[model samples]
Structure formats: C-alpha cells, structure tokens
Target chain A: MASMANQGAPERRPGIPGTPGGQPRGRGLSMRTRQLFWVWGFLALPVLFYGVIRFYPTLNAFWLSLTDWDLMSEPEFIGIDNYTRMFSDPEFWKVFRNTFTYLIVGTPISLVLSFLIAFALDRIRFGHTFLRALYFLPYITTASAMAWVWRWFYQPAPIGFINDLLGRVGIPQMAFLNSTTWALPSIMVTAIWAGLGFQIIIFMAGLRAIPTTYYEAARIDGLGEASILRRITLPLLKPTTVFLVVFSSIGFLRIFDQVYNMTTNDPGGPLGSTKPLVLMIYQTAFSSYEMGYAAAQTVVLFTILLCVSLLQLWLLRER
Target chain B: MRTQILMAGLLAGTSLVAGTAAQAVEIEYWQYVYETRVTAMDQLIDAFEAANPDITVKQVTFPYADYQTRVVAANMARKGPDVLQMFYGWTDQFVGGKVIQPLSPEVFPHDEIEAEFFPIVTAMKRGDDYYGLPTAVRSLALFYNKDLMTKAGLDPENPPKTLDEMVAAAKAMTEMDAGGNLSTAGMTLDMGGQDHQWWREVLVRQFGGEPYSADYSQVTYNDAAGAAALKFYTDLQLVEKVGQRGFMDEGQAAFRAGRAGLTIDGTFRLGSFSSIEDFEWGVTELPANAEGVRSNYASYFANGIGIGAEGEELAAAEKFLAYISSPEAMKIWLDVVGELPARRDVALTEENLADPIYAPFLKGLDYAKTTLFIDEAAQRQNAIDMANRILIDGQSVEESLAQAAEAEQAIIDKAK
Candidate 1:
C-alpha cells in the first residue's frame, strides 16, 4: 500500500516541473527525488557530525568500558573486570548513593518550589516579567560563579552570610559545606537553586499554555480555585510536568558543576559525601586516568539516566 | 602594466616578511596561573627571548585546578606546549602518560643536573633520565602572625620551637566568642591543603614512621608511629581546641585575615603573604617532636618538554627549559616568586640562610622528604579523607590510618 501511494505521488504532483506526468523527467531528477535530495543534503552535515563527534565517542565508550585504557597505552581487553571492580568498590557505592540522593531529593523539591513560584507569579500583574527575569537570572549565570557565591554564603561568621545571620540570632555556627552530613544537602540546595530558575521559566510557559478557557469552564461548573488547579490546570499541564520531571531528574542525576565548584579544593569531599556519579567519572577518568573504570562508571550513569528518564515518562504518561 | 608590476612588488615584499618571520622558531610554554609566578615567568621569557633572538616563547596559563587536565588533553590531541610546568608529585603519572619526555643528556647532562641542583630535584628522575627540572623548590614552614602571638602573651620574635611549645602557643592564642565558637583560631587546621603533606612526610617521619618504603612501592605509615602522628594532628583541633577545620574557609585565608595565629604552609605562600600590608608574619621551622626529630615535605613544580615537540620545536623547548632552570632564572624566580632557588649554590648562600623569612624554609629542605606519588590527587585525597574520617566522621585514628594506608596501597598497586 505504501509503495502504491509512493508511485502515485509523482503523477499527482503534475504542477511540479520535474514530475513524471508534467515534463521530461529523464533530463532532471523527479520532484520527489529532488525533495529527498534537498532533505538529505541538509541532513548530511548534522548526520556526519553526530556520527563522528557524538555517536562515535559514545559507542567507543561502550567498547572502552570493556577494555583497560589508561589514556596512555594501547587499550587491553579486560571484559567485565571494570564492572566487577566498580561494584566491589565502596567509594563507587558511596558516590552512587550520593547521585541518587541528588535525584530523589533535588528533583521534587526544585519542581515544587518552581511550580509554586510560577503559580504565584502568574496571577500577579505588577512586576510579573521582572520577577520572572529575576528567577531566571540564576539559570543564565555561570554555574561556577553561582556555586562560588553559594559557597561564600555557607562560610562561617564574619565571612559567610548565612553564618553571620545565624550568629546574630545567638545560634551556634553551622558547618554547611564542611560537615559530611550537611555537605551533600548543602550542595544539593545550591544545585536545586541553580536549576530553579530554568524550571520556573518552563513551568510558567506550561501554565501559560494551559488555555484560560479550561479554567473558565471549570469555574462555570462551580469548581473552586484549588479544584480547578487540580483538575483542569494540572491535567492540561501533564506534558510540561512530564518533560520537567525527566529533565530535572536527569539534571539532578548528573549534578557536577555545583558540587565540583563548591568543593573545588577537594571535590566530592568531606570524605566523598557529595560525590555524584559524573564527578566520580570525571575523577576516575581525569584524575586517576583509569579510563576503563571511568568508562564503566559512565556506562552505569548512562543506564541510570536512561532508566530514570524512562520510568518518569511512563509514570507521568496520560492514561 | 604598471598595476601588475606594483602587485608583483607587493607580493614579493609580503613573501620576504613571511620568510623572515618563519626563521624565528616560536614555542609555547604552559604553567598554572599564580600572580607572582606568572609575572616571574614573563620576566624569564623576556630575558630568554633577548638572549636568543631566533627563538620566541609564548607563555600560556590555566587556573591551577584545570592545568593538569588541560595538559593531558593537549597531549592527547598532540597539540601540547613545547614546555609545560607540572607538580613534582605528578612525575610518575606524567611519565606513564607520556605527556612529557626526558631531557636529552647532550643538552641537560645528568651529572650537571644532579651536581648543580638541590638533591631533592632527583624526584623527577626515573631510571637514568631526568624528566624535568625546577627553577625553585618549596618546603613547609610554620607561618605565625606576630601580632597574634604578642596578643597571646607569647614572644613575637621567638616562634614555637617544639610541638608542645607550639600547642601551648596555640592554646594561648585561641579566643572564643560568647557562644563558645572560635572567634580566632590559634592555628589554622586545613587537612585539604599543606596539612596533608605535613601529616604524611613531616609528622609521620617525625613520629618515626616512613610514609612510604624507600622505593615508594609500599605503604608503611599505618603503624603505631603513624597513629601517633595522626593523633597529634587531630588533637590540635579536637583535644587542645586551638584550631578548627574549615576555619575562615581555609587555613591560608584565616592566616591572611589575621584570625589565625599560625599556619603550616609552604614557601610558595611567601610572595602572597609578603604582599599583605600591615600584616606582621614570621616564618619558622616546623616544630620538632619531643625527641627533637624534625621532618618536612619539600616539593616543587618542574618545567619539562612535552612529548609532542620534535625537531626545531623540540630543540627550542630544550633551550627554553635550560634557560628557565639556569641559575640566573632561578635567582629571578626566587626574588620574584619568593620560592627558594632549586640549586644549592644559588639558594644555600649565607645571605639566603641568614634571611629571617627564608631561613626556616631553607633549613627544612635539609631533612625534607618528597613522597613519590603514583597519583598525586588520589593520594592527597586519601590523606584528606583520613583527616576527615577522624575530624568529621569521628573515626578512630588507627582505623583512619589503616584505611588511608590501604587506599594508598591500592592506588600504588593499580598504577603498577
């Protein structure tokens, strides 16, 4: 059936100069063929780019995960050894837990915070755009700069803003970034805050996309504000919520910049308390130069990202 | 036509200029960016360029954190600098990664390098080849604030000469606020910085435990002496309460802000500390243990020719490396960067030894041990983790020491 339709396409397009039924098709390419030619011509560069730049390295990483390549000598095949080593390593497990902690705690907190802000800002007429821009400002700022600023805010009295405030209230000084227990959460707070701007902007756009008519109809049906939000606004915003759930989940899972910049001297430190998988991968690959081990970590992270994203999409899918 | 003749003459002029420019060999040199070091390097480059007109040197720098990664990436891409600066502890990794090549004996004879430079420079030697050379070397010393010492009712000029004396001075200087939090740290305790080095090479040895075997193939700092060293370090904060981890963010910062009475730092801090106005700081030898045993960690960043260079570029890099390691360059580096010269003849002079600020650091080099690190970052992280385990996680010193030893041993094994 598809072939029959394709065969009829050239005949149906008689107005096109190069169509078989309209002109001498032997001298020039058929209209359909030309269209395909143009499409492929435009696609060739990106295809070649992804092939060499992205896909090749990605596939090579999978191969490298099975071999021992220390970025110096020729890679030697050592199948499953990297994976076994990663599994047995206690540090890897610590980093694994840290990575998930970011995803589990960071995603929901950031989403809810951004949603609340967006919802509140949506109703306000005065300074709405200004407020939106203010929230979005952090997203545009450099991650390292933001992380450093947050680091300063966590410093002890006379230096850190938070500590000075706490000190004024006769409260004991808190070790925000320095404490092993507090360091991960402290870094997570920064990561979530850094991502809040982007999430808020996205949520606002999603809210705006929810037609006013849905809310109006719901109100006409005697729905309260809360009821309307629960039924009409939220149901209509499923697509946006799904996208953000996956996006923010992936972001939290791959959190690196904030943690790294915050703990620049000893990244993933205070005893590897805040290390995410990506940071671990970076340290293994760059610091330790254990390419195979790092590659295995990367593969694990890639699998987690894939599973988490898929699971989120499935859970949030419209029934 | 007249236009054709003019065009031809213009083309000839451009070619002639290009020909002349091509005669001058240009080589790039890379180092991590520290203000004084960069300035000193620029000065050396200027002098070197003046001396060798045919060779042009371009100085490139990256932030210290990103410098190693950049060098590795550049090496992998085959676009590395002609000469690159690297930490002495990175010698093994750099040699294994082939990021740097050994100096040719014809240009930098091993006998001369061994005889002229400080004995510690042998850290760069692998087998019979010397992979790099340093213009200046660094050793840990006790940096004390004179005003803070005076305020604590201690003699400002006579810094602590013994561990017990240092602890006493620290306790005297420590000040608590109304909330019982440290308002001023008597001593800055930063495990993430030079404290790790001090704990490994200085404290461990001073306590009678070698950090690593003589061949550097085994971990040996997990014994009783190692635990004692670890206890002494942590006790400075935990028991005596003279210092706090993460005080004023970093030990150097606390000392810089005059909130810290003393900090164990390397000679590299000399330039930065000297620049602080109204800050009366003094440098003294690291305090000896009760047995009067003293040990220190001496380290340096050495200049090496990248493996990427060949032929003319390689030759130029060799000459540049030679020039940078020369006595003249070492003197300039010492004066400008405040690091002790790498050569005994240049740095061990009566003037340098008698100079109050440099004397302690110079004296430290006499018994200083430079740990041959397999992976400096990982090994440093082990030390940092050991300290954190005791300080933060409240782990036992013996347990932490054992864990650190095992971790370091694994790293050495993996490198093998």
Candidate 2:
C-alpha cells in the first residue's frame, strides 16, 4: 500500500513531467500551456455537450420566437407577431397569473413549513435521523406517483380519502381538483408538499452549519428562544435562505408534472384555472403544433425566470 | 496469418453472396399502445408474414398521449415507421407535416375504397388523394349498468330510449350520502372524455342545430338550438342533479366501478368493459330527442404509409397496409379490438348485427356523423371549457355556447 501510494503521488504531481526534479523532456510547451491543455481536455466533453444540446437550442428558440413555424412548412419571419398574439390571448394571461400564484403561494408556505420543521428537528436528539428520513421520503418519490396519490385523495366521497374523512366528521364535501376556484390551490398544496422534503433537508443542513457558540453566547446573555432565533439564527441563515428562495422560486415558476398528472384528462383544466405557463407552452407546442408560438412562450418564461431570480438575489443580498 | 486471412475473405464472400440470393424487406409499423389493438395487430402481422414470407414487419408503439409527438420527432429524425397508425382526426396534421404519403392509386384504388369502406372513411381524403385507410371504425353508444338500473326500480331490460326517459332514470338511480355527497352517480358527466363528442355531434344535432356548416369551415352551433343542447347537458348536473362531475375522478372509472348507472362511451370501451368480472352491463343506442331525432358521433384510427418509406420498404408498407385493411384482418380486429369493421359489408353482417353487445354501436353507424376536426384536441377542449363555464362558473348557457363557438371558429380559421 505504501509503495503504491508513493508511485501514485509523483505521477499525479503537477507540471513536473517525468521523474522527481528531472529536466524537461522538451522546450516545446510551457508549464501553463500544459496545465491549460489538461484543464480544457477534461472540460471539452461537457463544454461541447452544452454547446450543442443546451446553448444551440436556447439560441434557436430566440430565432424561432420571431418566426411562424408550424413544424411542417418553412418558418416565416413574422416580426414579433407571435409576441403580439400572445399578449392579446386571454389564455396566456390566465396562465401567467397561475404561474405567479404558484410561485407566490407555494414558495413561502413550503419554506416556512420546512424551516419550522427543520428548526425543531435540529434541536431534538431522539430518532432525529429517522424522523428526517421520514420527512424526506416524498422528496425521493416520483412526482407523478405523488401527484396521482394526491389526486386520489382529492376525489369525491366513496373514492376520495379527504372527502370521506370530511363526511365522517360531519363536514360538507369539498370539490377539490374539480372546482376552478379550488383546483389550483389543491394542486398547489400537493406541489408544496412534494417540495417540502427537499426544502427541509436543505434547511436542516443550513441549521447544522450554524456555529453552536453563538447560541451558547446568547444563552449566557439570557436571551429568549424567539429572540435568539430572530437575531442570531435567521440573520446567520441568510445565505441558505437566499439560495432556497431562488431555487424554489424557479421550481414553482416552472411547475408542470404535478399539475399535468393531477389533471391528466384536462391538464390546466377546470376552465384552464390550474394551467401554469409551462403547461400552456406544452399544449401550444405539442397539442396545437404551434412551434413558433410555443417558442415565444418559452422566451417569456425564460425572461420571467431571469427577472425573478435577479430580483431575489438583489433583495437577499448580504446587507 | 496468410491462411487465416484467406479463410476470413472466403467466409465474407460466401455470406455476401447468400445475403443477395434471398432478399427480405423489413418495414417498421407504429401505433399507439392499446392492449387489444396491439394484440390484434400482432395476430394480423403473423398472418401477413406467413403469406408473404419475404417481407418482415416490425411493430413499435408509444403511449396514446405521446404518440403524435413521438411520430413527428421520429419522422424529423429520418427514423420513422414505414407504416403508421393515426387517429382519423389527425389526417390534416399528418398530411401537412408529411408524416404520411398519399396512397398510390394503383395499389389503393379510390373507387374501391369509397365503395367498400363506410362513408365516414372519407375523412382521410384530402384534395384528390386518399392518405390512409382503417381496419375498424368506432361510434358512441349508451353503456348502462344493469344492476344499478334494477336497484333504481327501472326495468333492466328496457334502457332509456328518449331524452326525458334517460334523465328520469338517471335521477332515480342517483344516491346521495347522509352528508349530501354523491355515493352513486346516476350518470357520469366527464366533459373531458367522450362527453364533448356527445355534446358536439349528437346532442347539438338532436337539439336541431348543425354544429358546423356544410364545408366544415365555419361554426354554426351558437344559435338557440345549440344553447338548448348546452342547457340540457348542464341541467343533468345543476337542475336535475342526476350526477356530479369528477365523481370517481373519471366517467369510465365510475362506470367500471359500478358506481355509475349509465355512461356515454365509444365502442372502443367494449373490450375493457367485457373484461370486468361479474359485472352486468348492457349497451343501447343514445337516447333520441322529441320527434325521434337521432344523432351519433363516429370516429376511427386509420393506417397510413409514412413518407419515410421508399423503394422496397414502400412496397412492403403498401402490401402491409392492404393486408391490414382486408376483410380477414378487419374480422380479427372486430373480434379482438371490439371496434366495428370499417367495411360496410364486413360490419353489417348478420353475425355482428345479432351480437347484443355490438348491435347498438353498429346501428349507430346509420345516423352517425364524423366531425371533420382540423384540430380535434383544441376543439374538444373548447367544448370542455364551455361546459365548465356553465357548470363551474355559473355562466349562462347562451354565453358559454357563444364563447365555445368563437373559440372553435378561431381554431377552424387558423387551420385554414
């Protein structure tokens, strides 16, 4: 083992070509050039992959958004007619509002619930790992499966668990996932629940990273638990909060699977009340075969994501 | 080394010669993955291969939801099927996208196809060319649970024959829990499913309205007749309170679970419904309105030769298409997939007409209308949204019908 380790160490050593303190084999290349060659050689695969797969398609979408391509005929240059049409389309505005509703209602509820659970979990010693794992189960489960289960829960009496429970307790049956007013919120609740596990795990990690000495110092100063949480804990957890806010905000904005699966028959349905922008884009592209219009919708989504993320980063800057 | 090289060359030469001696053409066939349809196709392929031993056919399937997208993507990649099955409603999109080539006149004679196949098969026609053919066609019918009807004190043998009778039966069969939540829905009201078709093709015409103009270029279901049709549908839930939407999450689910007294579904449901253990269900023609005006909706999935096929593959696909639409293959499709044979003679045979399960759907073909949908999904969603407006948003029937008409007209105009 010792001899093997010794052999591996010298070979891995940077910029020293063959043998320890040996003369350079040739004056053909400098140390920096050789180092850069190795660096780029390793990065070449990923760089090429992103260039072809990600960057090319992204640029193509921008060009496509300006044209009218129906995936059959040649794309005709339309000079922002798609943008004009999208702005005037009432469906697009409904989807826009729905997407914002998911972001606004879903993010804070998930974050606060996760933080509260994580904070309490971090302070406990008994079966902490098991409870954390329990909370994290939904995170690892497939979103479609989770959405279907929630869909079953939202069914009417004799089939739906929630409605059955309500009936048992003498409460009127709620028309969840059926009522236009309730469908979005019902789906939002599932999205929030599906996302809670990941957020909780992240919050726990952030909680663990906080120095225990600060708490000890606060205890010595006879600080209340709430004050210690507000003054020391929250302010210290700012970085994690900012990251989660941006991450989850992006997630909520681009929500699709739960909404699609829960309303499989009529996705974004109950009069398009539950439709997010992504689903609308999907329907436009695949269902209607309006590729250019879908591309325009994609451009709008990308812009929204950019602005929202930037706003969050600016708002949560280290001040 | 010299000896080994000589031996390798000799082997390669012999194999190349052997390959040229007996050439076999292989073609790929693509369809949506329905269990019975796939099974029936496999059986037909086996029979076809036995007769034409030189041609090999491969079957590929995608889920129904993703079938069109997959086919389009595959065609774009130059790896699409030689023969493809497509919904009759998608003929326009498929033709526009060049997913399929028009059937050659020499192989599929236009006169023979028009005469032998049902008139509804003409939906595949564009311009002067026919692009596809179907082995089987489907039409809607009333599916009733016998047990539920008997329990409701209605005669199980005699299902509803008139619109008023159907509503009365639905009201009688409906059972509510102590909490006033529906325990058993008298009828399934799924606007997203076959209900949209029922409303557009059946109810609208029965209520004295033409859903579309003769050329199918304009929407005409926004008048008083259309509003009355829309009102009757919504009244099943709002006023009559015979059923609830999303009761068992889906209309088919409620019917299958024996929690629904009646459901309006296509003949494609026959195989699934027949498989239910110990369940007694019956099929009947959709109820006629006052003055005995009867209307129904007919649809089918047709097989087409993909644009990707060329030379030997094209010949093979043409042969396979002919074989699948032949009388023998249509019979197998009827037995296995439970869809009515596309050929009028094949479907209207005494044996098929005598079968209680298929008779109602077969009879429906006489009065059924095949909607020339340019964009079936979008147009169906318009109907669904129109229903939601009345049922969910409490919008007036006239307003909802007008909105639906406008939306449908826009779809038609865009397609044009």
Candidate 3:
C-alpha cells in the first residue's frame, strides 16, 4: 500500500486518508523535537551541575544561617540568632576592616603598575614576548613557593635580602612581617606583586582588541598619547575594567589562603594586624570547631560578597 | 522544562522507595600514622573479626597538615570519625564539647595501666575519664655527640652536671673557622620538637614558677620566676649567643655533620637517626633547672581505640586494638619501630632499656614530669606559645608572660 501510494500519490493515500492532512504538522512536530533535544542536551547538564554544586550549597548555607547545626545532630531552628550575634562581633568588624584595607590599598596600586607595564610593552619594539613572559612568570609560579620566597625576602633580620639591600643604601633593618604595623603592608606588597601579572595580561588584551584606527583618528585630531589613552583606551575598555574590578573584589574579600599561610593562623599575631575575615571563619570552623558559629560567619561573608557584586554589576554593567 | 520535570519525577519516585531501604551503619576512624603502621593495625582487625564479626572499622590516615581540618569538615557533615586522634593541644576542644567517648577505669580498665605509665602520659584526661589512650610516649633527653665532646677536651662519659657547667663547657667546646661561620657550635635548643615542651616547661618550673596556677584558674608565669626563665632563654640567643634556633637551623643536620656539640629532643627521632654512623652519640638526662626538681612535661604521640557507638564492626575494631597492643605485637612496634613503649612493662625489656643507646633515655624517664590531665591543655599550649615567642623573639619577658596569663585566664573562664 505504501509503495503504490508513493508511485502515484493516488486518491491522497486512500488506505490512510487522514495522514495526508497531518503531513506538514508531523514534520513541524519532528523539527520541534530536534530543537528541544539539542537545546536541553547542551544546556541542561551545566545548569544541573551548577545547581547541585554551587547554587544548592549556597542556598542551603543561607538557610543554615537561621539554624543551629554542629554537623552531628539535627538542626535546631533559631531564626536570626546567628545574624544577630554577627552584628555585635568585634572580630567580624576587625576582619572586614582588614579585607577592605587590603583591597583599597593593594588593588589600585597593582592595577596602576600593571597598566603602566602593559602600556610600555605595547610601545616596545624588541623582546616584547620575553618581557611579557618575564613580567608574567611570578603569576605562573606556585603560590606556596612564591609565598616562601616572599617570606625569605621579608625576613626580619640583618641577613634578610631586603634588609641587606636597604643597608647598602644606609637604611636600617625593618621587621617586614614581624612588626604589627608592617606585617599587613608587607603582605599587601606580596599581593600586589602576584596580582600585577594577571592585570597586565588583561589590560594588554583589551589594548590589542582596540582598533588601530582609533589611535590613527586621534593622531589626525592632534591628540597626545596620554590624552588618547584616557579618551580612547580607557573609555572603550569598560567591560575589561569592570571584569577586573569585580573579580578582584571577590578575590580580596575571600583572601584566606595567603593570610592563613603567611601568618601561620596566629590570631592577632605580630599585633593582630593581618587578621582577615575569611581567615577568622576558618579558625572558627576548623581550628576551634565552632561550626554553627562558623556557619554564621560564612553567611555574613556571602552577603557582603553578594552585595558588592550586585553593586558592581549595577554600576558597570552595559545596557 | 521537560528535563526538569523528568528529573523531579525520578527523584520523587526514588524517595518513596528509599523509605524502606536499610541504612548502613558507618564507622569512621582517623589516624595520622600512615604506611607500615596501617598494616600493623590490621593484626587487630583479625582478632576483632574472630570475636564479634558484625562491626567494621573503616580506617583512614590523613596527612599531618590536613588531619584536623578533615575531621572538622567530617563533623560538620554529621559523619566525623567515630574515633579520632586528638593531639595534646586539641584534646580540650573535644572534651569541652563532650563530643568524645569517655574511657573510665570502669569502662576500659586503665587504672593499673595508667599508674604504670608516666603520670604525664594521661595529661589530656580528666579524672578517671580519658578521651583517648596513649599510643606513643616521649620525653626529652640529652643527645651528645661523643666524638665532638671528646675532641673539645670534655669527658664524653660525663655530660654537663649543672646549667653553669653546661654553659662553661659549651663556650669552651664551641669552635669557629677563620671565616667566622658556625663551624662547630657547642649546643642548640630544640624549639619545634613534640617534646620541646618537656624541656622548656621544666626549665620554667626550675625557676619556681608553674605555667598554670594550682587552681588551673590563672597563668602564674608572668611574675619573677617567669621573667627570670624568659631572660635566661633569651640570653642563650642574645647575650651568650651559644645556641641556634633549632627549628630554623636544622639540628639533625648539625648533629650528623658534626657541627653541633649537644642537642636535646624526644626518643621518637631515635628511629630517624638510627642509621647515622658518622659520629658516635650518647643520650643523657636533660639538665635540671634547679639542683633537683624534675619538672618536665611528658610528650606522647598516642592513638586511641574505641568501638563505634552503632558500628557494624564493633567486635572487629576492639579485637584489632587488642592485637596491636599485645606484648608480642607491641614489642615489634617498640624494637623495630623504635618508638618508646606506651606500656611500662614492655619498655623495661633488654631490647628497649638494657641496650646502651636506649639505657640513658630510660634513666632520664625517672626525672620526667608529666602534664596534668586537664581539659584545658590546648589553652595552656597557646599560653606557652606566647611565652616562647617572647623569649625567643626578644620581646619583653614580663609583657609576654603577662599576655600569656591573660590569655590563659580567658580560656580557663570559657572552659569552666
């Protein structure tokens, strides 16, 4: 019957008369099925994975903020108590202050230095890759090794490299990591050194992406190099700038590994100067085993991070 | 949207069937001893299996650095190690929360064993209730390079009898090359060893000051004796300039390479140094701070054995522990492993105490003092760390001790 119908299309497939009327509709249905398969297959796995690993945990953590659970027993619902205690925690404010201090002082300095280097590299004629790799080498180096090297450099003794260099120029030995006053600043220096590489790379990429015609147009208009950078480069690199700014804020806010490793988790050590917030949460959770309290701390940290990210998006996000 | 619906339906369907499934009784055990020690632990499992085969012991060893964090995370997950090793400093945190199983003399019968072992061995316990058992015991003893002492005109047989004599002899024995680098130093302090507290606390005790008060309510070291002790230690670095920072400058290398005269450390490192043959070394008692006061805290590297509350392999776990601590088995541990015995009777044998190398360490145990088995051990350690930093880092002795006192008081108050 199918062969006869194909051969002649006789009487609109009389054996199954309604099928002819539904042919275009059936083809449309199959097309929709194919579209759904591709769309769901490509997109669903990532969404599910993200939901379970990141989003669910974050949401559960926030929900956990309203309860008391020590990971042993059933969670007790104690609404707003954890949040309430956070308001009065002196250590919270101190840690928050330390993080802000690091971001405020360290980030801008690193960004500016990286920008200058990138600008210079863009203008250089010879050994550009070598110089770029040289500038970027420290970033690629392992954090533990770099931290140790920086520690040796910041050693509080006459034998310290920095101190010895200073002595050559008639300056006395300074306790870079040992003094309460100098320890935070010393860490900031390390942070700036490590961060500058990535910033330079990002800025260079943005610079490269900018059309040469913009510079040519500016030159025809008799604009200087500095003015062109400010007018053409800076304004056009909004996306990159916002990207760096938001990412760096998140990085600085969650700066626990450096603070913990560098300071050996000594609270108020060398005068309680390098105590950052995330470090406090770690000390509370693992070192002290105050999970419920640590959970409380984590919720506050999340809130702070979330608000900052949202504000940055609001301020710098393109329409 | 269809995928989400399908996933939701599948999950709901699974939940309905999950209500009828049997839950596995999970038991977790965490230890720091890895490699052969883990294999040695299996002998206990065999014995446990023979007794009551229902329970299973899932043993794991974490790296030293991550052990604490892993345990904490496990606890947070509501599935922490049913039995875990708590160090000297960390014991109090467990006891403070009452999170650990209490081994009373009634429950585990450690009364005779406790008396036989050094009093300080149970320093982490509270009364008759102990959170764990002493798996390894350690104490500080003088380790002298016999060749260096003899070459420097000091009798190798007769080590320093007094602090003054030690200082004088160290000064005499110390030699410097023409270039003025430390070619051979007379003595250096072991500041980072597990047993360092024994020597440091003993020295402080000699000056007539206890680290914590009799009540455990105050840190009493901020006063005159504490100041004197602090000054004396700092003088070794500042005024005398005799000793090097043992932690920063590797003491083992100094000893093996024949650059050091005298070093003091625990018996545990004896295993690590058993193969060092370049120099002849002898062990002796640590120098007394006073003429006679034996005021050292005993340092022990211990592992606890306990049955999981609802573990499937409870019988197996207990049997494994018994097998490991047996006389024959523990002898293998003591002789081959070279760790000092947690059992006094096993320790006194010809292989352990009678040997020339091990005899002097045995003798030093006579003068040893142990820490009080209190709940606030870690807090005491924090206070001690402050005191150590002050003395070693050239901070004011009085101020450091005072800060330590303040810190100790706060911790004590919280514990109470």
Highest-lDDT candidate: 2
Compared with the true structure, what per-residue lDDT tens digits does model 3 show for residues B1-416? 99999999999989876743333233556777655556655554455445544445577888876776666566645556666666755565555544455654553567765666655556656665666666556666777888988888889888886667677667766775443334567776444343246433776788877766653556666778877876776566566766545322356656666777877677766866677888888877777654666554556655543323434344333444444445656666665556666677777777666787666666666566655333333453564366456644657777776776676666667555
**Counted clashes in each candidate structure:** 0, 0, 11
Q: Provide the fnat value for model 3, as a fraction from 0 to 1.
A: 0.08
The lDDT per prediction is 0.89, 0.91, 0.66
DockQ of each: 0.48, 0.68, 0.11
CAPRI class assigned to model 2: medium
- Pick by DockQ: which candidate is best? 2
Error of 2 at B238 (Å): 0.9
Measured against the true chain A, the candidates' chain A TM-scores are: 0.91, 0.92, 0.85
- After superposition, candidate 1 runs with Cα above 4 Å error: A1-27, B1-28, B53-60, B308-317
* Candidate 1 colliding pairs: none
**What lDDT does candidate 1 reach at residue A125?**
99
Candidate 1 structure quality by residue, lDDT tens digits, B334-375? 888888999999999999999998999999998888888888
Error of 3 at B322 (Å): 2.9
Error of 1 at B139 (Å): 1.0
Could you give candidate 2's per-residue lDDT for residues A1-319 as a string of tens digits? Answer: 4334334544455555755664464245655565566567678999999999999999999999999988776789999999999999998999999999999989999999999999999989999999999989998999999999999999989899998999999998898998999999999999988888899999989988999999999999999999999999999999999999999999999999999999988889889999999999999999998999999999999999999999999999977
> Residue-wise lDDT of candidate 3 within A135-239, one digit each (tens)?
898888877678767766875333357865766676665767666678888888877787778888999998899999989999999999789988999889888
Tell me what TM-score chain B of candidate 1 gets against the true chain B: 0.96
